[model samples]
Target: MASKQAQRLAARQQLQQRMAVKAEEERRKRTVLWSIGGVAALVALVLVAWGAVTVFGADDDEAGASDPDVAELVDEAEAASDRCADVEPSGEGALGTPTEGLTDGRPAQDVYLECLQMSTPDASATESCMYTSVDGTSPTPLSVQPAAGTQKMTIVTNLGTITAEIDTAGAPCTAGSFTYLAKEGYFDGQQCHRLTTESIWVLQCGDPDARGAIEAGTPEMAGAGSPGYQYEEENLPVEAEANYPAGTIAMANAGAGTTGSQFFIVYEDTSLPADYTVLGQVTSGLDIVEQVAAAGVM
Candidate 1:
């Protein structure tokens, strides 16, 4: 009876040892699976973070590419002659000297004889007109007035070339300003910053301090650059329905007599109150503007 009892005890001890080994093996297997899952999750998060950085980095690069440096344009401006220094008006109806209170919005007498009359066959029948400024300051004084006739200018751009005709008959002052600025290479290396497709179908350009070129969150300083002077409006439409037709090139201004270097090209018949100076008409390259407009703003 003692031998049988001892044999039973040995059998029970062997069974318990086997069960302890099996439990340890199962615990190790579960630990290996948990470690693999953790590693895989970390790899997935890394991939997602890399993808986000790549996508956002690409977008920032594209924006930088589109916005050209304003410093380049400023360098061009500095190379030109300082036409505003010691300036004096020239031509038949030029001001004898610079005067104050000219750009005061309200109608004032032509103090400096800056007002001119268009010469006609009957010289006595010429109507008097004034060249007003925005801040009561003249732009680099045009030493000479533009000759009377349809002056032609070729606007070369990266996209295309635009040919325009400055109508000296209708807008002599505005034409003269453009002629002077073009000669000084002011418009070179400049891009059209603003494009409005709806309500106003036009492409505005000629801001030396192109605010668009600056990165986002930077203060904008566009549409504020000038040739150190301003001019009055000319050739405003008489009839309300006399809209600026497609291909019409006109000046952009802050208000009355505030014409600056910025100008807009009408891609479609746009109805705007005749507040802006009618600079000229685009003879060619209207299609280029239309194509740009079709692509829409990026």
Candidate 2:
């Protein structure tokens, strides 16, 4: 009887902690968003935003892509799971998919909102973060704070080497993951696979499996790749009209908390729903991405 009582008490406490985090996220959403839409184009790039299919959201039936990863994470009281299942959407979500009902695959838009809901600070973590292990191959990130308030990420391409200034202040966990992945030589020879020429101008890269299929002249056969572990989003620009501006680099995921190695570099000022996590600014090598964008997608 005493053990059961203790278990109940513990469950109640966990629920309260989760609710507190969700409430703060709601408050942040209510605030912080303003108009940065008319910021003017730094370059004559594209318009519109990345839709569900092509960008971060995915539809997979593999065991690794099951619902347990999201719903059960919170139910099991995992430290990293902020319990986004309980979050109520502020508006009619991007996909209008029901967060409550599901038969097989989850709606991409719903996954996106879940990402937004849990994209806040833990306030209870040590330096090391327990990124959800997916394939047991992801490298653990170093500290989010490197040096000079920002860390430098150099991307050497066939065209030219592009350098970025990772904003650790904004997305510390993401920064750490990037650092670890880079050290492990994860991005060694991976091709920058997806490039959008229409309204959204970006060079999407980092997918390990995006090569052969795309090169075989069948782009549709390409699959989404991950870093083997997963982590929730952080440093969301939920308030900006042009949330992703020119020279911005951000993560690409299949849904909320499904962030993988894939990322997009914005060569234009774009406004998508504030679902993706902003990594930092592409301080250099914007020209390289721009040149590729100008040439258009193959």
Candidate 1 Cα RMSD after full superposition onto the native fold (Å): 22.4
Residue-by-residue lDDT tens digits, candidate 1, 1-298: 5698799999899999999999999999999999999999999999999898788655443322222332232233334333332323332211123224222111111111111111111111112234445467655633324334555656655444567776765776666566556645566545455666677788877766553343232323445677767767888875565389888888998988778788888989888988987777888879877865655542
**TM-scores for all candidates?**
0.53, 0.54
User: Model 2 over residues 1-298: C-alpha lDDT tens digits?
Assistant: 5699899999999999999999999887656442223333422233323343334333321111333432332223233223333334243322333323322221122111111111122222123344877856644443222222555666655555566777755676777676556544566555566666555666787776655555576655544677788888877887666789999999988889988778888988888878889998887769877765654433
How close to the true structure is residue 14 of candidate 2, measured as C-alpha lDDT? Answer: 100
Error of model 2, residue 54, in angstroms: 49
